[model samples]
Structures are given as C-alpha cells and as structure tokens.
Target chain A: MKRVVILDPLWPLEESADVIATLDVTLDKAAEAVGDDVVAVLAAPEQRVPADLLDRAPNVRLVGTCSTGYDNLPVPELQAQGVTCIHVAGYCDDEVAEHTITLASALLRGVHQLDRFTREGGWWPFPREPRRIRGSRLGIVGFGRIGRLVAAQGNVLGMDVVAYDEYVDEATMRDLGVEKVDIDTLFETSDVVTLHAPLLPETRNLVNARRLAQMRDDAYLVNCARGPLVDHAALGDALIHGAIAGAAIDVYPVEPPPADEPAFGWPNLMVQPHSAWYSPAASLAPYTRQIDDLARFLRGETPVGVIPGGS
Target chain B: MRVICTDDTWPIDRAQATLDRVGATVEFAYEVPAGEDIVGLLTYPGCAIDASILERVPNLKVVATCSGGIDHLDVAGLAERGVACCNIRNFCDQEVADHTMALIYACLRGVVMLDGLVRSGSWWPYPQPPRVVRGARLGVVGFGAIGHLLVQNALGAGMEVLVVSQHAGADEIAAAGATKATLDEALSTSDVVSLITSVTDATRGMISTRELALMRSDAYLVNTARAALIDHEALGQALEAGEIAGCALDALPIEPAPPEEPARAWTNTILQPHAAFYSEASEARSFDNPAEDVARALAGEQPLGLLQPVS
Candidate 1:
C-alpha cells in the first residue's frame, strides 16, 4: 500500500479526504509520515522542500505543488533525484486576469483616492482629473492566458489593446484583437501598461528605469504577475517625479514587503499583498485538481499536470 | 454675442479660441451675480440654474450645459423665458460606464478592503474571501447608453447580466445579450446591482428600503449615476444590519457629503465624490460641446442637444 504525506494543509483535510479515498491510499500529515513507505509528498507553492527534507523520504517518487508558479520549486534538483514534479497551472487564470482588470480599473477611475477623499469629508470634483479607460490604449506584456484575458476585457470596455510578447505569433495576436508592438512602442503608446510575464532570468527587472522613462506622463502601470518584473525603486522614483501618473502593484519581490518600502507612502501607488490569485473558488480549485492528479499518479496512470523534464 | 461661463476653473481656452474664431466674446465667472444681461449662459451639470438665477441673467437667450444631465438646469423655467436650453448628450457615456464597472469590480472582488488589509501588514492570505466576478449575476437599472455599455463589458467578463429599464424593450435587451427583468426581480437575483438611471421625478429615490430589502444579504450595490436614486438613510441602516454585503457610490444626495452622514461610518461602503463623468478627454468634450452649441445658437440654428421642456 502506498502512503501519501501532505506537507502543508493546502485545503481542509476533511474536505479533501473523500477525493484521496478513491486512490485507496492512507493520508497522513507530514509530521507522522516517515521512511521509504512514503511514495508521494503534497506541498503548497510557498513550502520550501529542501534536499535535507527530501533525504528523509528517499523513496518518494512524486512531488505535487499546488500552484501555477513553480519559482519556489527547485526543478533541477528534484529531477536529478528521479522524482516527478507536478504543478497545477491554468487554475487561477481567470481570477488573476480579473484581478489585473480590477487593479487597472481602480487606478483609472481613481476609486481608492476618491473613496478616501469622500470618507475624509472632501467634496465632489476631485482636485485631479482622472483618465478614462474607454478609447484609451491598454498595453499588455507577456501575452499569455491572463494577458490575453485582460486584453479581451479592455476591448469590451472600448479600449485599444496592444501587447508585447515574443512567443505569441502575429496571427494569434490579430485573432485576439490585440495589436503586436515592440516593448518601447507599448510603453510609449499605452495609457495603461500591465505586466503578466512569468518570472525568468532574462525577464528580471524588465520594467527598469529606461522603460519607466518611456511611459507617458499620465499613464498608469499595473503589476500582478511578479514583483521583480518591475524595478521597485525606479517605479517609486518615477511616481515621485511625476514620470507616470500612478501604479497598482499586486506582487512584490518580497512577500509582505518591508514596512519602509517607498511605494507604500506614495499617494498614487496602490500596493496589494500578492492576493491577486486568491479567491474562494481559485484557492480551492488548484488543490482539488492537484489531489485528482495525485490520485491518477498513484493509480499507475499518466497524470495530466506533470512538469516537463521533471521526472 | 457674449457668453458667460459659470465655472471659473473650466478650461475654456479651446472654447474661447473657438468662440473667438466665430466672432463671439466670452467671459468667465464663478457666479453670474445679479443684473448681468448675459446673451448665453455656459454652465456645467452641478451648477444650479434655477428661475432666480435665470432672472439675474435676464437676457439669457440660450442656456448650454457642459454635461449630458440637464436635471440641474430648470428646463421649464428656461422654456418659460423663451430661452433654448442645450446640453451635451452621450458625451461621457463611455467614461461613466467605465467608472461604473470599476466600482462594480471593486465591490464584488473586495479589492479596496484587501488593499487596506495588505497595507496594514496582514499579507500572506487575505482575511476576507473575494467573490469571483465570472459567472456572477449583474443587475443594471436603466439601460441607456452608459447602461448598455456597462452591460456589454459585464457580459464580456463572463457575467450574466439582467437589465431593468422602462425605455429598453425586451428585444433590445435580448439583442445586447442581457435578460430583461422587472426591478424587483433584478434586485433579488443579482449578485451586484448597478444604478445607471438618470435622476427624474419617476426615478428619484427608486432604490429605497423596499427595493434594498429585495437584494440578497451578500449582494452589492453600485451607483455611478445620480445619488438621489437611492435612499441613503435606508442604505446606511441596511448596511448596519448586514442586509446587503456592501455599496460603492460615486455620487451622494449632497455634494461634499456632510461630515455627519451615517453612511460615512460604514466600513463596507465605498464613497466617491461625484467624479464618475470626469476625465481629461471627457472634460475636453464637456467644454467643446457647449462652445459649439453656443456658436450655433448665436447663428440662429437649433443646437445639437436642444432639450424639449416637459409639460
């Protein structure tokens, strides 16, 4: 009999117990499971599975991460150990895309500022004039599933959508009703620029000082994918110097960014605590799907979400 | 012809230049003051053009408002004085619709609350559960240009839209991919109810205690149109009793809502100053439209947006 150890309680253990029962496997918490009998370990994306921890379960054959982003997983080390790694992707695509639009809409319409103003007993007709999303340009970086959805939402709002992505072909871009443009053109032409690229070595600090300088003076920037994609210091400086109008950042390089982060005090910037991919539905779906994938793996059938070059 | 602009801060340079080209003199003032025989009164939506104000401008042959709503202008009074009243129609439909959707997204997803929580250092997981907007029901009241645009955007976001409007026929609503429902039905079934109706005797105080009671306790109400459409006192009480989940308001019965307003103390309520129709692009149209209307009035031609007085 195969034993499954869940390193982290991704979802309520009781709710997931029914699904795990189908595989005819006994579920045990990480603390109780020991030795070579444990063939699979389920962990959240935030959980760090160091080699020292893996050494305890030498016979473990599968590691399932309940998240789309695998930055937390050390892929090479796991593959070298002859372990199959799986991650649930595309589960929160709609949630993140909707969040991207939410951030963009809030910034464009001045929801945060106006809400505060009214609460503070300020009068109508804000001191600053807000820009409209309709008939404006929305520039999307990394035209993946979330990026494409954001573009579609922008189109429905009557915005002219443009995008910069190396992988998406021109025909696909046209089919999605997004105009393909170079990075610089996107920054310069867009009324709002949103980042959705995966975190990669080549893409780190993609929105640096030079790129921020290229954006329109009244334009807004939204970052929901990852924090390193934007140079936080440069973005702060750009916002302070009025280089750009405002920014809405959902992900930071560091979770729960330091208290003294400069962007925190800036009136024009809205900082969210990397909760863009979280909703009641989104939080549960990834876990449920991962559990099903784990069940399939245990049944000696090919699982659907296996990461490439992982096994 | 001489034109008196009621708003001193209005960017009338373009309009002034246009008037200059048309051989008309223009004067800007914060108020009309008594005994000013202005040939044309150029005003905005918030300015009160009551009978007394018109009496002050005895020679006011034409009253042109730089907004779509003519509720502030005494159309009957203007007509009684043989003065033609003109307003810009559908100028900021896209702007208001965009703002309405922004508020809807903010309330439904709890973006503002999450932002507050994250800013307060509660980072890893959001304390409040966010509602997914996709597959949700959105009830829109008054399917005019702004309402129709909002419906289109909401549908594009994969939401089921229900519309309630006296003027919109069943066929028109169906054609827009929305179901036509009575006000009571829309209130009870929708996850988010948005008010986009113009303020009139028939529509004023439309969403009062009875209508609010029909809404689900977890639903939200978003109002970007006139504030008089809702009974704020009832809304405050309902929010206190947890009758509705929340509200996002762009306008209030009183501009610069008094400090003692009960709704201000409700944490679940989001209050924005009457700024839904404000944008640099929209502002430009507000000024340009009145300028053109004044020019046309001076030339003895019917203005584009002439409003017929209600009998």
Candidate 2:
C-alpha cells in the first residue's frame, strides 16, 4: 500500500479518505511517517515543504497543495528533483471576485465608517457622503480568472470595467466586455482600483507612491490578492493625507499586521485578514480537486494542474 | 422672486447657480422668519414643514424638497394653502440601489466582522463559512426605481430575484426577470431580504418579530429605504436570539439614532446614518432639480415632480 503524508491539520482528510482508499493508500498526519513507503505529500499553501523535508520523503514523487497559490512551495527546486508539484487553481474565483466587489462597495458606500459610527452610539445621520458604485469606473490590475470574474460582476453593477494585464490580449478583453488600458491610465481613470496579481519579485510594491499619486483623489483602492503588491508605508501615508478617498485591504504584506500598524486605526481604511478566498463552497473545491489529482497520479496518468517550472 | 432654503445641508452654490439661470434670488437660512416674502421654500427630507412653518412664510408659492420622499412635509397642509409641492424623485435611484447592494454584500460576506477580527490581531481564518451572493435567493420588498435597478444587478450576478410590491404589476415584475412573491413568501424563502418599500400606514413596522420569525435562521436583512419599515427593537431581539443572521440598515426610525438605541448593542447589525441616497452625482442632482422646480413654479409651468395630496 502507498503511504501518504498530510502536513496540514486543516486538510479535509476524512472527506477525501475515500479517494485515497481507491488509490490503495494509508494516510498519516505525522510528518515523521514520511519515509521510503511515502509516495505523496498532501499539504496546504502556508505549509513549507522545503528541500530538506522533501529529502526525507525520497520515495515521494508528487506534492499536492490544496490551494491556488503555490508561493510557499519552491517549484523550481521540485522540478529539478523530478517531483511533480500541483496546486488547485480557479477553485475560489467566484469567492475572491465577490470579495473584491464587496471591499470596493463597502469603501465607496462608507459601510465600515458608518458601522463604526453606529457601534459608538453616535447620532444617526452622520455627515458621510458616499459615492455610488454604478456609473463609476472599476480598474482591475490583473486579467486572470479572478480578475475576469470581478470585471464581469462590475459590468453587472453598471460600472465601466477597465483592466491592465500585460499578458492578456486585447481581443480577449473585448470579448469579456472589459476595456483594456495601460496601468497608469487605469490608476488615473478608475474610481475604484482592485489588485488581483500574484506576488512575485517583479510585482512586489507594484502600487508604489508614483502610481498612488496618479490615482484620483476620491478614488478607492482594494487589495484582496497578495499584500506585497502594495507598499504599506505609501498606503498609510496616502490615506493619512487624504490623497485617496478610502481603501479596503484584505491581504497584508505581513499576516496579522503588527499591533502597532497605523493603518489599522485609519478611519478611511477597512482591513481584513487574508479571508477573501474563504467561503464554504470555495474551501471545499480545492481539497476535492487535489484529491482527484492524487487519484489520477496513482493511476499512472500524468497528474493534472502541474505548475510549470520557473512560474 | 425670493426663495428661502431651510436646509443647510443642501448644496447652496449649486442651487444658487440653477436659481441664477432662471433669474431667481435665493436666501439660505436654517430658520424661517414670520411674514417673509419667501415665494419658494426649500426643505430637506427630515426637516419639518408643518402648518406653523407655512404660516411663517405666508407668501410661499411652492415647497420644493431636495429629497425623493415628501413624508416630512404635510402635503395636505401645503395644498390647502395653494402651494405647489415638488420633490426630486429619480435623482438618487442609482445611488440607493448601489448602497443596497453594498449593504447586502457586507452582511452576506461578513466583511465588517472579518475586518474587526483582523484589526484585533486575529489573523487565523474565521471558522464560520461566509455566505456567497451567487445563487442565493434575494427578496426585494419594493419594486420602485431603486428596486428595479437592484433586481437587474442582482440577477446579473446570478442571484434568484424575488420581489413584493403593491404598486408594480405582475407583468412588470416578470419583465424584469423577477418572480412576484407575497411578503410572507419572500421573507420565508429568501437568503437575503432587502427593504426598498416606502414607509406608509400599511408598510410601517412591516418586519417586526412576527415577520422576522418567518425568515431562515441564516438569512440576512438589508434596508436602504425607510427605517420605520422595520422595528429596530424586534430586530435586535431576533439577532440576539439567532433567529436571523444579521442586518445592514441605512435608515433608522429616528435620525441621529439616540445613544440608547437597542440595535446599537448588537454586533450583527451594520448601521449607516441615513446616507443611502448620498453621492456626489446624486447630491448635484438633488440641488439642481429642486432649483429648477422652483424656477418652473415661478414661471407658472408645471414642476416635473409635482405631488398631489391624497383626496
């Protein structure tokens, strides 16, 4: 029987046990159980499956991450060792997309500020003037699955959707009914700009001071993708000086932003932990897909959802 | 002609500009003096224009309101004094619709609560699964302009739209791709129920304890219309008892909700300061329309939004 190692406690082990059974495998959550008998490792995005950890499981040929992002896994190193690394992508597209819209809508409509007012027992009819989402321009920084879904929803809300993605062709954008624009124009023209790009070396600090300065004074910024894409100091400063109207951030440069983080207390800023991709339906999709991939690997068919080397 | 504007919150410059175009002089004063030559009286939604106030402005020919609803003004009293009362009805339809969707999204996705968790240094993923807007049933309580726009957007986002309205015909609701539902059916079957109906003798306190009891335990309620349409005390009790999940309210029975408001203690509630119809675009329209109506009233032409007192 094949021995499978599960490193993440949050993994839906019981739900996917039947699939593992079909592969004639015995699953163990103990990392120490990873030995010669282990052929696969099931992990989460936050779990670090480094080279040393992989070295212990020499017989392991497949590493399946039950998440769309594989930044925690060293893909190039795994490829060099002839190990297949797969991640579930496109599982939480709708969830993340809806989250992005929610952030933008909340910021524009002043939901967070108003909520605070109500909680403080402040008088009703506080002088908060909010901008409407309809007839406003929505700028999507990435044109991937999640970005496309946000754009489609923005169109449904009667917003003029514009996007910036170097890799997406103009024809495809037109087909999706989204206007293609350069990054600077998108930042300048959009009333609400959202980031959906992956965190990469080249993409780090993409929303720097210069780009932020180009945004409309009344515009809002929302980040639900990865936090490193935005400069924390610049965002804080911009919000402080009222360079922009407001912001709603779901991801942070550092998880559990330090207690002293100034942005946490900003009246104009709405902060959320990295919980955008979390919905009952979305949380289940990835684990189920990863289990199916593992079953396919055991069948000697090339495992699907393999991350290309250097990506 | 001289016009007396009683609301200081109304845009003075915009109203003045429109009045100038039509060759009318305007004076803005929060207090209306007795025996003034005020040919036109400008009032806001929450401001009272009773018989006493009318008697003060004995020469008042028209009462133009910078709001959609004329509930604050005694329409019968105005008609008895031979005064034309006009309101800006459709100017903020899109704004209210946008705000309604924002509240719905905030409540369903637990955006406000999740933000609080992150701010308090709770970075772990929230254990409770968030509700998704995509396939859920959305019950809209009214089918006015705002309700129609909300229905279109909700349907576009893949939600099943259900509407209950006394004024809208079955064909009109069906043409909008929504099914007609009675108030009980809407409350019982919907995952999210939004109140968009105007407050009236028949509709006031429509969602009290009995009506709330019919809703699902996990469902949410959003109100961007009148606060009198819901019983706040009952809503607070329902939330405390877990009879319903949560609510997002833009209107309260009392503006500047007193510090002792019961709903203020409920964490499941999101309250805004009656700001649903506020947006830069809508604010501009609110001022411009009332000024034009004043101009038309002076010119002996019919005002666009003239209101006739019920016989």
Candidate 3:
C-alpha cells in the first residue's frame, strides 16, 4: 500500500484517519520523504519539503503545506515535475487579524508593561500611560483580507481605522468604515500602526529606519504578519532610543529566536512566539482541509488550494 | 470656602478653575485640614472616605472621588451623615472596556505566554498554543457600561459572547449581541471569562474555590474590576493545579503588588497594575469630572455623579 508522509509530529493523525482511509493511503509521521512508496508529502509552516524530494520519493504526485505561506515549498520545480503542490489559505485569516488587534490593544493599554510594574512593586502613578482604544487612530499597512478584518474590529471599538494598500481602493475601504491613506500618512498620524503585508523581496524592510522615524513618539507598532516586513535592527534601535512608545512583534528574523534573542532585553517591547495561527477549533483545520484536498486530487478532482504558478 | 484635594497627583488647577467661578478656593494637602472653612474634599480611589471623614472636617458638605469604583468610599455611611458623595463614572468606561478586550485577546492568543516562551529560548511548536478568538466564547460577568461596551467590542471582533449578569435580563443581554448564561455554564464553557462586575457584598470573593473548579481546564479568567471579586488564594491554587488554562489580572488584592506577590509565581498568569481605566483623555476626565462634581456640590447644585444610597 502507498503511504503519505506528514512531517509535523503534532498533526492529528487519528482525527485525520477517516480521510486517509478514504484515500486508501497509510499516513505516517516521518522526518523525511525517503520511501518510494510515499505518494504524498505534507509539512507544517516551519518544516521544509526539499526541492529534491522527488529524487527519493519518485512516485510522489502531491506535495502540500498545512499553512498559508509556501516559502518552504519549491512550487515551480515541483509543478514542472508534474506534481500538484498545494497550501492552505484563508484558514487562519481571522486568527492573524485577531492576534494583530490583540497586540495593538496590548500596546495601547500598556497591559504588558503595567503587569511588570505591578510585579516589581512599582505602582500608583503608572510609569507608562494606558491609551484609550476608542478614537485612537489605527493604521493598517496592508488592506488584504486579514487587514480588512482588523479594520472592521478597530472600527467597532470606535477607533479611527485607516489602511494603506495600493490594490485596495478608497471606496472599498469606506464601505468598511475605513479611511484609505497613503503609507507615509499612515506612519505619520496613526496612534497604532500594524503590518499585515506579505513578505516579498520588494516588501522586505518596508518599515526601515526612515519609516520608524516617521511614527509619533507616542505611537505604537504591531506586526503579526511577517518578520522580514520590518527591519528588525531598526526596530531595536528605535525602541532603545524611545523613537516610538512601544512595539509588539510575533514574528522574528529567526524562528525560535536564538538563545541570545536581543529582543528580550529591549525595553518597552513585547515579543510573541510565532503561535498566532492556532486555536482548538482551527487547530486541525489546515490539516483536515489539506487532507480533504488531497482526497479530491486522488479522486481526479481539482484541489481547491493549488499554488497559483503550480496550478 | 475651601476645597482640599488629597491626592498629590491631582492637577488641582483643573478643579480650581471650576471652583473659582463658585468662589471656592481648592488646594492640594497631605491631610484633611481641620477647619469649618473647608466645604469640600476631592479624593482618589486609594483614599477611604466614610462617616469618619466628617470628624476631620465637621462642616464637610460633599466628597468626590476621581474614579468610578466607589468601593473605597462608603456611600451609605457618608450619605447618612447628610454628605453628598460623588464618584466619577463614564469617564474611563471606554478605556476599561478596551483594556478588557486587550486582556481577553492576550489570554486567548497566549501572547503573554508566547512572549515569555520566546524569551526563555523556545519557539513553535508553541509551548502555549494560541486559540482562535473569532469563534471563541467569552463570558462577561457584568452588564455595566464597561461590560456592555466590551460585548460590543467582542461581537465586533466576531467572538461568541456569553454574558452572566444578575442585573441584566436575558433579553437585555441578547439585545447587546451576547447570549445570557448562568455563572456555572459560562465558567464551564467559555474560552475566557472576564469579571467586570463591582465588588458588592454579594460579589466580593464571588469567584472562590468552588467557582474556579467549575471552569474548564483549558479556559482563562480575566479581571479588570476589583481584586475582591475573586478569591486570591483560590485563583493561585487553580493556576498552580492547572484547573484553568491561565488568567490576566488587572486588579490585585494589594495594589503595587508587594515584592512577595504570590500571583507573580502563579503559572500562565498575566499581572497588570490597576491601570486599566486610563488614557490621556480618560485620565483628564477622571480628574475633571470629580473636580466639577465637587464644585457643583459646593455651588448648591446637584452633583452629576451623585451615588444615591442603595435602599
């Protein structure tokens, strides 16, 4: 019998057994797709499916990642070899947006800082003032699905919501009660600036030293999108010099940031591990959805989440 | 007539302007000056005001506190002595609601824990996996201005909210875009339960050992109200035993949590100084409203924040 390899040890194999049975494939947790009997290989966002996978698992017909980003997958190379490459999209949009809003609120309210202050026996006059969420300006760097959701949430909290996205028109933003602003204006005026843009070569370091300097000294920054979107070093310097009130970042230039993660010592900064896209309800969603897609591909049906270029 | 502002941090200038029109001179003082000329006294949440205060200033006509929570002020005792008591309200409602939502997000997304994990040289697989906020059920334990505003905030963010209130009816809770639930049900089912209710006789230590035992092991508790609303020992035990996933506390049993604060050692808890109800604008309102109320009371006008004795 053919086998499917899931590189994520935490993958809900027992819960996914029904789907595996339907496809008539035995799913096994593996460190690598080295067996010729492996017809399908799947990976979590942090795991990598090397481009040379086909060299070992020659019969592999499907390669899927249980995440929105496929940076770890060689889509073009896999598709050229007649392999169907897929990635789960739109599964964690709400989670990412919620996390972004949470980080923004934490910064504004000084929840993290106040907590530390209290534990340290310093209280009474709050060293850092907690800001009001209502009427505070929330500027979104990307007006994509997740960004739009964040704008809606901020608007509901009575915040002045604005977004900067060249692809998203002003009228569209207005429909969601969001004001469309230029990127420079977003950085200059927003009380809280959050990044929801994808990580691309052109988009990398979008928040450079100049952009950080553009922000109000009392303003805050939140990044739950991608790590490389902002210049990590610049953010550290800005924090050191108190260029901005504070920042909350979930992603980093390096995952599981090295033992000497400089962010730990940075004052007025909140560091979050890259665990935003999770919840018991949505925890198995990506895996189940991907497996269902795999089953569809097995039945000669088009999978819903095939990579654009690969498809 | 003279008005004394007991809190040194209070900007007496804002209140002095209002009193100036009424021919009342207000000044900051360390203690209540013993004199028939003192007509009014302005205090903050930390100062305990009751009938005993009348002994210090026998001719005291009114007392005002620059905070909504009147737990520190004995309204009934002061009212019995023919003294009008006013506590600031609606001034920081939005700030409290926003901060509550922030803590809710922090707990559900495990941002605080995740941040600690990253700093401790760990990363994904998330030591504390974040939960999806949109569909997560939030149990709000009050129906006051802040709780109602929080319901709007949560619903706007697409969270399923369950409100447990003795004051609000099922229809009223439902009208606010939240489901009405019994305390047990809310505790047993919700992903996060927030306490925004005041600490009345029936509410003080409301969340005790039995109550903590009702919560789902994976659930969290957030308190932005008063520390007395929960049993500190019970909460610590619950956290130590993992009876609940975690908790975020804005109010501690002791303000400026002493060097030996037990909660600091509790597992998966986020501690916040009593700084939830704050913002530059809200802070000004907190001081301005109380000052104006005291001025009104001195001017032979009914105070807007008059706390009528609960019959």
Candidate 4:
C-alpha cells in the first residue's frame, strides 16, 4: 500500500476514511514524509512542508495544505519537480464573510468595549455609545469573492455598502448592490472599513498610518484577512490616540502572537486568534476537500484544488 | 401657550421647531410647576406621569413621552381629565433590530469570548470555538415591528429562522421567510435566540427555570428588550451550569448596574447599558415625534401617538 503522511497531529485522519476507502493508501501522522512508498503528504496551515520533501520521498507526486493560504508550503520547488501542489480555497467563503460582518457589527455596536465597561462598573453616557447599523456606511476594502459575500450580507442588514478594488469595475460592484469607491474615499467616509484582499508584496501593510489617518474619528476597522494587510503598530496607535473609534481583528501580525502582545494593551480594540475561517462545518471541509482532491489526482482526474504548477 | 419639558436631555430647539407651527413655546424645568400656561408636557422614559401631575399643570392638554412604551403613564386616568397620553412608536424599530442582530452575531461567532481568551495570553485551544453564522438557527421571541425587522435581517444573512409569537400565524411567519415555532421549540433548537418582547402580566418572567432548562447547552440567548421578560436568578444558574452556552444582555433589572450585579460574574455573557434603541437619527426621531404629537394636540388636531385620546 502507498503511504500518505499528515503533518498535523490533530488532523483526525479516521474521519476521512470513507473518502479514501477505494484507494490502497495507508494514512500516517508524522512530522515529515519519507520512503519511496509515500505518494502524498498533507498539512494544516501551521505545519510547513519543506521543499526538500521530494529528496526523502522521491515518489511523492502530490502535496496539499488544508487551508486557503499556502504560505507555509514551499510551492515553487515542489512544482518544479512536477508535484501537484494544492490548497483548499473557497471552502470558508461564507464563514469569513459572516465573521467579517460580525466583527463590523461588533465594532459599530460597541459590543466588546461595552461588555468590559459594564463589568468594570461603568454605565452610560456609554463611553462608546452604540450606533445604528442600518443606514451606516460599510466600506469594503477588496471586492473579490469574500468581499462580494460581505457586501451582500451587509446589504441585507440595511447597511449602506461600498467597496474599493482596482481589479474590479464599478458596474460589477453596483450589480452586487455595492458602490465602487477609491481606497481614500473608503477610509475617509465609511463608518466601518473591512479588508478582504489577498496578501502580496504590493498589498502588504495596505492599511498604514496614512490610511488610518484618513478614516473618520468615529469610524471603525475590521480585518479578517492576512495579518500583514494592516500595519499592526499603526492600528495600536490609532486606538491609543483615539484617532478612530474601535477595531476588531481576527488575524494577527504573528500567528498566536507572542506573550506580552502589545495588542492586549490597546484600548477599545478587540483581538481574535486567527479563527475567522473556523466553524464545525468548516473545520473538516478543508481537509476533506484536500483529501478528495488527492484521491481524484491519484485516479487520473483533474482535481479542483490544484494550485498552478508555476511560480 | 407653553410646553414644559421635564427631561434635561431633551433637544428643545428641535421640539421648538415643531411647537412653532402651533404657536407654543417650549421651556425646560426640573418639575412641572403649578401653572395654567402649560398647554403641553413633554417627558422622557425616566419621568413618570400620573393623574397627580394634573394637580400641578392644570391646563395640560397633552402628556407626551419620548419612548415607545407607555408603562410609566396612567393613560386612562389622564384621558379622563381630557388630557391626551401620547408615546412615540416605531421610532427606533430599525435601531433595536440592528442592535439585536449585532448581539446575535456576537454570541454565535464567540468574538467577545475569543477576544478575552487571546488577551489572557492564551491562544489555540479556543475557550469556545466560533460557529458558522450562515445556516445557523436563529430564534426570535417577539413578532412586533422590531422582531419583524430582525427576521428580515437574519433571513437576509441566510440563517434558518424560527419565530415564536403568540400573535403571528404560521402563514405570516412563513411569508416573512421563517417558520413558526413554540417558545420551547425555539429555545431547544436555535443556535442563537433573541428576546424582543415587551413586559406584560402574561409575558413577565416568561423565561424562568423551566424555560431555561429546555434550551440547548450550546445555544446563546440575546435580550435587548425588557429585563423582566427573563428571570435573572434562573438565567444566572443556566449560564453557570453550562445548561446554556452564554447570553448577551442589553438590559438589566437595574439601570446603571450596581457593582454587585450578579450577571457581571456570569460565565460567557456580554452586557450593555440598555443602549439597544439609540442612534443619532433614531434619537432625533424619538424626541421629535413625541414633541410633534404634543403640538398636534395643542393645535386642536388629533395627535398621532396617543395611547388614549381625550373623549
């Protein structure tokens, strides 16, 4: 039997047994793959699959990561050797959009800060008075799949939804009930601005001091995308100086931010531990989708999750 | 003619703009002084109006309250004295609906709990795993204007909605894209349940020990309505025993919650300072509508917001 190694210890391999029952593959959990018998290796977002994996398991023809972001996977080298590189995508589109809306709602309604305030023996003239969600302007920073979903959800809630994306045209956004605006207009006028852009060299630190300064003092920010999308120091300073009202972030500049995280001290800020893409239904979807794609690839079928085999 | 405004926070300028048409002037006062010149009395939720107030303002033609609820007004007794008892309605329906939905999203997504978890320097093993919002069940406990708006919001978000209302028929609920359910069914089946009902003899203490026991262990309860709708002691027990996962309360038995409030120490609860029905627009409407109704009564036209019109 061919071997399939899983790099995540808690991957629950047994749950995917039915999906791979037809293939003569034995699943094993390990830090790394080895031996000529190994045909495939899978990993979670946190577990890195090194580029030299082909050196140990030369016959390994497939590699997959159970997440949308393949940052931890060394894609270029593995693809050079003709390995099928795959990562789950669109698996949690609804989840991330929902979580983004939740964060935006929390920031607008002052859910987090007020909870702490009430606990610490304070009351109204609520240090941060809750605002109306309906009619409040919602500025979406990226108008991709997830951004469109957020715009739809925000529209249903009666929020005035607008978006900014250089790649997407105004008519497309307007068709989705979203107004197209420039990045400066988004930051300056929105009651809450959310980011849904992919991380790249040009997109990194997209929300720097300049963008933060352009935002209205009563406005809020929400980021569930990559951590580096916003300058972490600028976010903390915005909250510290009351330049903006509040923010809710699910992803951090560092995964599981180190102890003594400066974010803990930022007033009027809500921190989440990179869990925006999670839900009971979504937790197993990425893995199962990846495993099914691997099974498909082994059977000479074009798999859905294959990342293009080039840099 | 003079309109006496007893609430210090009332926007007299806006009210004067309305009272202008009826040739009535508005004045602020700590109490309604015994004066025949007082043709209208504008009060807020905090100020109670009984027949005894008639002895102070003998010429009062209308007693108007800047709130939807008329619990503080002796409507019948005041109407017997040829005084119209007017209270604003439908002024903050959108605000309440938006706030309730925000709390619902906050509860299901576990943003507040996760924020606390990250701040405590703990990551990964989420204290409570965030759940998916789309396809998650939402139980709405009332079917008034606010409740209807809330169902629209939830249904728009792709949530399966189960509405419990004594007055709404299944056809009506289904017409609104929701299924009708009994209170017990809603409590047991919903992932997040919101209470938006008024307090009445039949509804008071409606969610007590027996009702709390029927809730799912993972369900979240949201109360943006009157605190009397729930039994505080039973709710505290349900949360501590983990019978119910958590609750988000925007109202409490006491306003300006004292330091000893028990809900403060309850597990996985979010508290707000009874701030659900507020927004710059909604606030303006609440005050302006009541002031306009008072002006209407003084002008010999029928007042729009009268709980009991003078015979």
Query: What is the per-candidate TM-score for chain B?
Result: 0.93, 0.93, 0.96, 0.91
Once fitted onto the true fold, the runs of candidate 1 whose alpha carbons sit more than 4 angstroms away are: A1-3, A23-25, A31-34, A123-128, A258-262, B1-3, B12-31, B52-55, B258-262
Give per-residue CA lDDT, model 2, range A1-311, as digits (tens).
Answer: 67888888777777877786677787778755357898888788767677665667788888878888776677777777888889999888888999899888888888888788766876434545687787789999989999999999999988899999999999999999999999989999999999999877799999999989999998999999887899989998898888998899987766667898788867588888777898888877888888889889888886678877723
True contacts kept of each: 0.79, 0.84, 0.92, 0.83
Tens-digit lDDT string for candidate 3 (A17-71) = 8777777778888899988899999998778789898999999999999988777
Ten contiguous residues with the weakest lDDT in model 3 chain B: B116-125
Report the error of model 1 at residue B57, Å. Answer: 4.0
The whole-model lDDT of each prediction reads 0.84, 0.84, 0.88, 0.88
List DockQ, one per candidate, in order: 0.71, 0.70, 0.73, 0.77
Interface RMSD of 3: 1.3
Measured by TM-score, the strongest candidate is 2
Model 2 chain B worst lDDT run, 10 consecutive residues = B122-131
lDDT of 4 by residue, A153-249 (tens): 9999889999999999989998999999988889999999999997777899999999999999999999999888999999999999999998988
Q: Can you tell me the DockQ of model 4?
A: 0.77
True contacts kept of 3: 0.92
Q: What's the C-alpha lDDT at position B236 in model 2?
A: 87
Candidate 2: segments with Cα more than 4 A from true spot: A31-34, A121-128, A256-262, B12-31, B36-38, B52-58, B125-128
Residue B56 in model 4: lDDT: 78
- What lDDT does candidate 3 reach at residue A238? 96
lDDT by residue for model 4 (B67-157), tens: 8866667788888888888888898898889988888888888999899888887777677888888889999999999999999999998
